[model samples]
Target: MPAPIPTKVHYHKQARELELGYADGQSYRLAIEYLRVFSPSAEVRGHGKGQETLQVGKKFVGLKDITPTGRYALKLHFDDGHDSGLFSWDYLKWLIDNREANWAEYLERLEAAGASREPLGIEIRQL
Candidate 1:
């Protein structure tokens, strides 16, 4: 079976999110920061397991543009200068399905490294 294609793809700059709507009446919102941190690029995912680089201080990263890669993937340009990842349709679906767990795991990894999502010199406001 082929991976599903999104019927709608809209980037909401004000919300800093990408909204995807499917044919089955399902929809998902992916934060720009989340996409940047979890990019499938070798720089982020690494060449092999256990070699992945931890992406920190990307809480404010923005999407500069999105370009299609043939018919199977998307090339996402990040304002932070990263644009290597090819987000395939399958990968996008996987991201949406595992978003919650992935996010939690990312936070755990950051905390373990004593890192903050906030960019350098930016203070994290505690409520």
Candidate 2:
């Protein structure tokens, strides 16, 4: 089967989500933070398998912009200064299909690494 092609893409600033509409009538709303952590760049995915880096302290990270990379992918510019990942159409579809599982795995990894999603110096102090 051929991969689904995106028919429309919209970034909702207030919701901090990238809404994608595909040719197969499927749509997905991906969070900015999710895109940041799961970036397909070498900085995040690393040089090879088992070399994946854990991204931390990006709970509030936002998208600066998203530019198309030819007809195959998108280059996302992040507010936190990460701008290397090329988000392809197939990869985007995969992300939408596996969002729940991927998010759970990310949470598990974060917990194992003793990392917090919250940005640095921002503490949730209880009164």
Give me the runs in candidate 2 sitting further than 4 Å from their true place.
122-127
lDDT of 1: 0.90
lDDT of 1 by residue, 1-127 (tens): 7679888888888788999898999999999999999999999999999999999999877788999888888898988889999999999999999999999999999999999898998554422
Worst window of 10 by summed lDDT in candidate 2: 118-127
Error (Å) of candidate 1 at residue 98 is 0.3
Best by TM-score: 1
Error in Å for residue 87 of model 1: 0.3
Best by lDDT: 1
lDDT of 2: 0.89
For every candidate structure, what is the RMSD over all alpha carbons to the true structure, in angstroms?
Answer: 4.0, 4.3
Question: What lDDT score is found at residue 116 in candidate 1?
Answer: 87
Off by over 4 Å in 1: 122-127
Clashing pairs in 1: none
Q: What TM-score does each of the candidates earn?
A: 0.92, 0.91
Write one digit per residue (lDDT tens) for candidate 2, span 37-84: 999999999999999999999887878788999998989998888999
